[model samples]
Target: MLLQTAPAPGAWERLLAVLKEWDFAVFLKINTVWTGAFGDFLMPILRDQRTWYPLYAFLFIYVIYKFRWKALPFIIIAGLTVVLTDQVSSTFFKNYFGRVRPCNEEALRGMARLLLDRCPSSGSFTSSHAVNHFGLATFIYITLKPYFGKWGLLFFFWAAFICYAQVYVGVHYPGDVSCGAVLGVLLGGFTAWIFKKYFNFGNRKRGDLTTASPTV
Candidate 1:
């Protein structure tokens, strides 16, 4: 006869306590919306990926102008960064966590101040917006850090604001955004590092990660 070992003392309880605390904090923020202007500003920025098409196209074009054909490889890797972050955050993490989005929460129906009249019909433990943008930001930052120095940091701030907008619109909790951002950073930073190492970026031996970093 074997004796079963008990789970770590109070560990589950502590975890539950932390989750409850976070949910309480989320409740506070969801009801704080104050302006039509804010919603107008954030909705366009937060929901529509197409809204940034011109900027994305401009970046691709600008990179090509700066580095010519060498820019093609980095642009491809950038696409991968978006795919990794968006898919993992939305498909895997959201389903695995199975937490209901604030917008979809029955209890929050009356309480949460919504920007759009509609909410997506999906699980929302992780914010896809945060993940995609942050991941892209991290990749871009690492790729261009050598040439642009401290200026590359702006990408992280840009990603953060997008995540904040998700919370403001009552779609995701702050924890969801925070966790998504962490995952994005890891995915982007690790991928960029790998690209650099494999491509011999330090010596520019086999087409380094960057030929000329753009100021934009």
Candidate 2:
């Protein structure tokens, strides 16, 4: 029998390995040290999309009620924003990186606490939840800011909250969510700019939604 020795990693590869270790350390800190009974119960709920069905419905209804026919294009663009973010993050980034979820890692079987019933088989470089939510948040903030003022900022906090819950629930690393957020923001902002440029929804002064608005 012949024994073969593998080549050692180069500096760049070694650096990436070190970064990965640091990411795992951060994941462990969030998953283990920052946990509690209340978090264990609430994070899963917060991170779950099912929990926000009512909010989604309300937003759909509210946009139509406020903007009438003009809401159609906004809705379409918003939906596309989420789809783009989800696909780019989940399909492209995940497949490219192929990083394992902490919960799904055999090495972390005893260490990582998985709050969900089953851990997904997808790769974990960029969190789809973070991408989707942050994309939507960015779209909402930019498109609706003229009407909602500073309240639009709340959308970002909402996105961050869900991303934090994702880490707390043990599915994604902090780096995954952080990069997802940046990508989401870029995509969402681009879509919003497109909508504003072509669709031309009434850009009333900040917080002034009472005036008769122009339709797209």
Candidate 3:
């Protein structure tokens, strides 16, 4: 008798294929259909690393000034979070999936609008920009929420805007950003939990917060 494959596996494959089609359709909607002059001008700027250098510098100094030596551990962990997410998304997921970017996709040869002068030659899935920003956003939101309260929520929006820019510029699909966001959140949350449990800055209230050693 011939061996038979399970029907569930076939169904799962069909479901994945349908989801991929939807992902592509949504990507086109964002990248091509839903667009504006202001967005076209601003998105590339929003996604540019150089644009955020001042902000990054400010945050680095602010944290050290705010927490003194205690901020050192937090800084190290935050840096590690970005490094981990970038490697996982760019090195692992992108290589494993090997999906071509919309700008490079043969199917979108004439349909896609590529804003960049030249598209990146890397794989498309799980955008590293999305992963890194979301990871940092989640880490910042979690670690600093106690001090910043509702204002910390803006970090998520900041990350999301960067992710949108990635799709708008035709470098990544919606699914890529979505999955990257989820993965980033997971890794960030885990690191945050570790920091809180072990390398906690202090237990002092936000108002009464003062210098404290990095200890549990």
Candidate 4:
């Protein structure tokens, strides 16, 4: 009888190793520095709940009103999917993996980096910011695809920017953000598909009729 084995790390680790090599280190450092400069300006905007919360709230409400009751289920499901992805990536996967944040690692100890202060002993295998932002953006994109036509590409760029910002801030490794992004895309799309199938928001069946016509 053959024994079962866990799957290999796949392309992500291979890519990370390439990035970590001495030859690539200089390139990574330069890119990181440039990204960090931009991140210094963008992180505050991305990280601020005050800014995003109102924006998301307004968008959600507007979507529901614009699309009518049919949009409510999608909005609610997308919101829940975003929260769930964030919690799972941050609380479960991070704690279970217990990976060290890139900012706190020995390699970065003496380097001057731009970012908010490092998190206090938090696990860092997968970035919550990357996961949540990508997940929510992806879900919204999927839900609104029919409405947006070819413009759905814009949402994809939005998700990618947020994922890149995570690494730029020095809080997450590129590998971490990459994994989070992949997972976020899968989960977001899957959740939208499931909601569309089961929610029955637009379909009204004959069985839904409450009363029959009089026989007079």
Q: lDDT winner among the candidates? A: 2
Itemize residue pairs with steric clashes in candidate 4. Answer: none
lDDT tens digits by residue: candidate 3, 1-216: 988976665788999999989988999999998999998999989988788778678778988998877788888998999899999998899999999998999988998888888899999888888888888888888887666668988888988999999899888899989999999998888888888888776544645655434455
Give the lowest summed-lDDT range of ten residues in model 2. Answer: 206-215
Q: What is the C-alpha RMSD of each candidate to the true structure, in Å?
A: 5.8, 2.7, 3.2, 8.7
Task: Give lDDT tens digits, candidate 1, residues 1-216.
Answer: 998998775988999789867775765554364447767676656656776678678778876776666676788888988888888987899889898888888866677776766888787878898888888889888886665578889878878877777777778888888888999999999879766765412322235445533322
lDDT of each: 0.75, 0.89, 0.85, 0.67
Q: Is candidate 1 or candidate 4 better by lDDT?
A: 1
Sort by TM-score, top down from the best = 2, 3, 1, 4
Answer with 2 or 4, whichever has the higher TM-score.
Answer: 2
Cα lDDT for residue 95, model 3?
A: 97
Per-residue lDDT tens digits for candidate 4, residues 97-153, read 997776677666666253665444788778777677777777777766555546866
lDDT of 2 by residue, 1-216 (tens): 888889889999999899888988999999999989999999999998998889778888987888888889999999999899999998899999998999888878899988899899999989999889989999988988777779889889988999999999999999999999999999999999998888856768555657536556
Total backbone clashes of model 4?
0
On the 0 to 100 scale, the lDDT of residue 185 in model 3 is 92
Clashing pairs in 3: none
Worst 10 residues of 3 by lDDT: 206-215
Question: Candidate 1: worst 10 consecutive residues by lDDT?
Answer: 200-209
2 or 3, greater by lDDT: 2
**Candidate 2 backbone overlaps, count:** 0
RMSD, model 1, all Cα superposed? 5.8
